[model samples]
Target: MKKLLLIVTNIDMYASGKLRTGLWLSELTHIYHSVKEKGWNITIASPKGGAVPIDPESLKPLVLDKISKEYYENPVFMDELNHSKSLEEVKNDSFDCIYLAGGHGTMYDFPDDTNLQYIISKQYESNKMVAAICHVVGGLLNAKLSNGEYLIKGKSMTGFNWFEETIARRKKEVPFNLEAAIKERGADYSKSFIPMTSYVVADKNFITGQNPFSSKEMAKIVIRELEKV
Candidate 1:
């Protein structure tokens, strides 16, 4: 079985700490369920070990989908979030793929987590898959390879865009614009013409999803890429 490291944020608040934010429930569940269906062994990890907070906004009636809702209601599944391993714990571990799940809280910690950067660097340099979606793509912004090159540099990818940030009313709360940050790092970033639509970009072993709605498709793409290996 191919092992997958599903990294999520531990920060439960925005940088200002005035607003609540954490992992976007659907982003993790959508990807988790899809990959689990393929029988991949998965581990949920974060910058700090322990419970990962769920974004309250993601649990809204209109936003929560059946799959995510199913996991949310399952005590067994929810327990995984309550006790995720810290990235440091898994720094020496190897995985076939490392997926970064997103939320507003990622804006605060993902880019600065050195252990995360090290994992991505080692994974990418070793020719393993490195994937991320939405705001968590921030994790890729600073990850550099052994050659000291940005992982997303010269790669075609997608992530939560500025327009979507505004649409979600998080333009002011987010620490940085995900799309702009990726471009600043030399990634060829693009998004769906209509916001919140499923848009995924696969550049070699690196796959990225544009938003939460893209998680299912992105997960499928990740599986497809894995099959090739």
Candidate 2:
């Protein structure tokens, strides 16, 4: 069976030290269910590893969906989240794909993670599919290919848009402008004109989703791309 490395954030609090944020439950679980149902084995990991935190707000009735709620109640899934591997524990070249799950917390740890960037670049250069959604795409900002070119340069991609950030009223809380940073890296960044809608882009082996709403679609696309490999 093909394997997938699912990376989520370890940061639980906003840089402002005022709000709590961690992995967005639906963003991970939606893709998890989608990919797992297709028989893909998944390995969950975090920058710090173990006890992955779910954004509390994501569990609220208004935000939590049937799939995410079921995942929250499923012991097997919960256990996987609780005991995710650390970046250091992940073996290079073991996975056929690498997926970065998104949340507000990713804005803190995803960017500037040299090890994570190396892992991503290695996976991409190795011809493995690499994917990310929402704020998790922040991790790709600094990733460089073996040729020292930005991995995302000239690649068409999409992630959590600035409009959505502003609509969420987190523009000030986020460490940096995710969209701006991606564009700065020369990625042909694009998003849905309507904020918070599902939007996905596939450029070569790199698949990206615009937001949590795009998670499942993103996984489906990833699976399709993997099949073509």
Candidate 3:
């Protein structure tokens, strides 16, 4: 069976005026379920190495529905989420792909995480695909290819755009701004025709989704790339 590393964050903070951690639930579910359906052996890991704190708002009935909620109740899934491997514990060479999940909290740690950067570099050097969504793409700024160039150089990608941030901000929620930082990286970026629409960018092996709405599509693109390989 193919192995896929699903990297999520265990950050739970209303820190410095910020409201939450981990990308919205709609971000992780489609990818999780899609990859599992293909018989892929998936390992869910987080920064803190235990009990990843999910955004409570995401678990609402209108969001996750019955089957997803039931799946969450399983001890196995709960265990995986609760005891996800640390970046130090992971064997980068053992996995076919690494997917970084996003949320505002990713901004807190994903970009500067040395361990995650090392893992991404190893995976990229081993000729494996590496993908990230939304703010998690910030992590790529720290990862370098074997040649020492940025992993994002010359790639067409997308992330949570500035316009969407405005809407989320206008709601008097979503503590930090995600888009401005992503655009700061200076890579070629694009978005869906509609702001905050589910948008996934597939530039060869690098896949990126714009925001929570785009997570499932991003997963599909990454899984498809793996299938081809």
Write out the backbone clash pairs for model 2: none
In model 1, which runs have C-alpha deviations exceeding 4 angstroms? none
Worst 10-residue lDDT window for candidate 3 reads: 170-179
Residue-level lDDT tens digits of model 1 in 111-149? 989999999999998999999999999989999977788
What root-mean-square deviation over C-alphas does model 3 reach?
Answer: 2.4
Q: What is the lDDT of every predicted structure here?
A: 0.91, 0.90, 0.74
Runs with alpha carbons beyond 4 Å of true place in candidate 2 = none
Residues 1-229, candidate 3, lDDT per residue (tens digit)?
7888888877766565556555455566667888889988888887767777776656777667554576677777776677888877885448888888877667666777888888888887788888888767777876777787777766788887767777656324544455554555666878889987788888776788887777667877887788888
Backbone clashes in model 1:
0
Instruction: Name the best candidate (by lDDT).
Output: 1
TM-score of every model versus the real structure = 0.98, 0.97, 0.88
In model 3, the runs with Cα more than 4 Å from the true position are 65-67, 170-177
At residue 45, candidate 3 shows an lDDT of: 80
lDDT of 2 by residue, 89-206 (tens): 8946479899999999998888888879989999998888899999999999988999999999999999988889888889889998899999999999999988998999998888
Clashing residue pairs in candidate 3 are 23-102, 51-82
Clashes (N, CA, C under 3 Å) per candidate: 0, 0, 2
